[model samples]
Target: MLSLIYARSLDYCIGKAGQVPWHLPDEFAHFKRTTRHHVVIMGRRTYEDHDTLLPDRVNIVVTTALAYRAAEGVLLAHSFEEALALARGADREIFVVGGVRLFERSFPLAQRVYETVVHTTVPDGDTFVPRFDFSGFRQEILERHPTDSRHAFSFEVSSYERVE
Candidate 1:
């Protein structure tokens, strides 16, 4: 199955200065747990922004840079189609991890989406997730996490499955 995962604010803000704007450990944990052992496809910028390649998963970084070099064990694709092809070869669930362009390209082909809605906004955010057509999917709220000492924001994790 092809799935997209992301946590965005009320205004669809996902990042600021190439990093997630808020620190919500629970949300991060949820993301880690869900995408672990799967094939994750992300754009070059998102791949670079992350401190290290996501562990225990097949990481495919989509980029147009022909000379771009990545760490060992990381796969590089020149386009979203190429990334999807590589992920499909792994025979595991495919998850589009981030960077707006990749999401925009993969959204229509995704069978499911795991979205965490953070109850706040980031006016200064420079990166945002693609706005999807939610009406075509059946929504289900999987978890609702509240603000705690370790988490600064309250968010709800929801699953969306394509109706057809």
Candidate 2:
């Protein structure tokens, strides 16, 4: 199955430019534990921003550039289809993590979404999660937490499963 995973602020902003503000240690831990042997697909920009490829998982970086060299532990693809093809026979879930463009391109193929909704607004942002019509999915709020006074924010961990 394919899943889309992200942590977004209350205003629905996933990132300012290309950075996610909240430090999601719990979320990362969950991802690492659950998808240890799975494939994780992301945009080239996301890979660049992260600077290093993740170990113990197949890192697929998607880009449209004619030519580029992949870093260690990264497999490069020019499109979402190509990325999926590379992981076609994998037995574990394929997770699509972001940068917005990659998210949009991969959303339709997602069978589920694991989202951490931060309960605060970020006044300035250049990136967003695409609006999705949830008619075909079932949503469950898994957990919620209030931000410490220093950060002045709160958030919920929600999961969405496709109805079919």
Candidate 3:
């Protein structure tokens, strides 16, 4: 099935200066645990931002630049369609975890969405998560994390499944 995952602030900010601005360890761990062993598709910047290929999953990096080079194990798809084509070969959930454009493009095709809402506003955000219409989906709260020393912002994880 096709899915997408992302965390955004109250103002819908996902990235600031090319990186996620929050330091929520629990949310990060939840992301890792959820997407593990599944196919993850991301934009070139998102893939490159990571130090290495995401272990234990098929990684497809979508890039408009035809000449772009990624790590040996990482597959490159020149278009979003190509990326989805490559991800379909795997019999696991295809998660688009990415920069803004990828999320916007994949929103319509997603059967599910794992969204983390961080209860804080990002004043200097450069990237924002695209607004999505959730009327067709049912939301279930998966988990909620309170603010603590390790995490500066309180957050809640919710799973939205399209109601057929």
lDDT (Cα) of model 3: 0.91
Query: What 10-residue stretch in candidate 1 is worst by lDDT?
Result: 44-53
Q: What TM-score should be assigned to candidate 1?
A: 0.97
**For model 3, how does the per-residue alpha-carbon lDDT over 43-143 read when each residue is reduced to its tens digit?**
98788667478999999998889898888898989989998998988778899998889999999998999999999999989999988899999999999
lDDT (10s digit) by residue, model 1, range 1-164: 99999999999999999888999988999999999999999888888887468999999998899998998899999988889889989999999989898889888999999999999999999998877889989999999998888988899999999997
Report the CA-based lDDT of candidate 2 relative to the real structure: 0.79
Rank the models by lDDT, top first: 1, 3, 2
Q: Which residue ranges in model 1 land beyond 4 Å of their true spot?
A: none
Q: What is the C-alpha lDDT of each candidate?
A: 0.92, 0.79, 0.91
Instruction: Quote the positional error of residue 66 for candidate 3 in Å.
Output: 2.1
Error of 1 at 4 (Å): 0.4
TM-score of each: 0.97, 0.88, 0.96
**Which regions of candidate 2 deviate over 4 angstroms?**
149-152
Per-residue accuracy of model 2 over 47-118 as CA lDDT, tens digit each? 877768788898888889868777876888898888888877666679998878778887888889988787
Clashing pairs in 1: none
Candidate 2 clash pair list: none
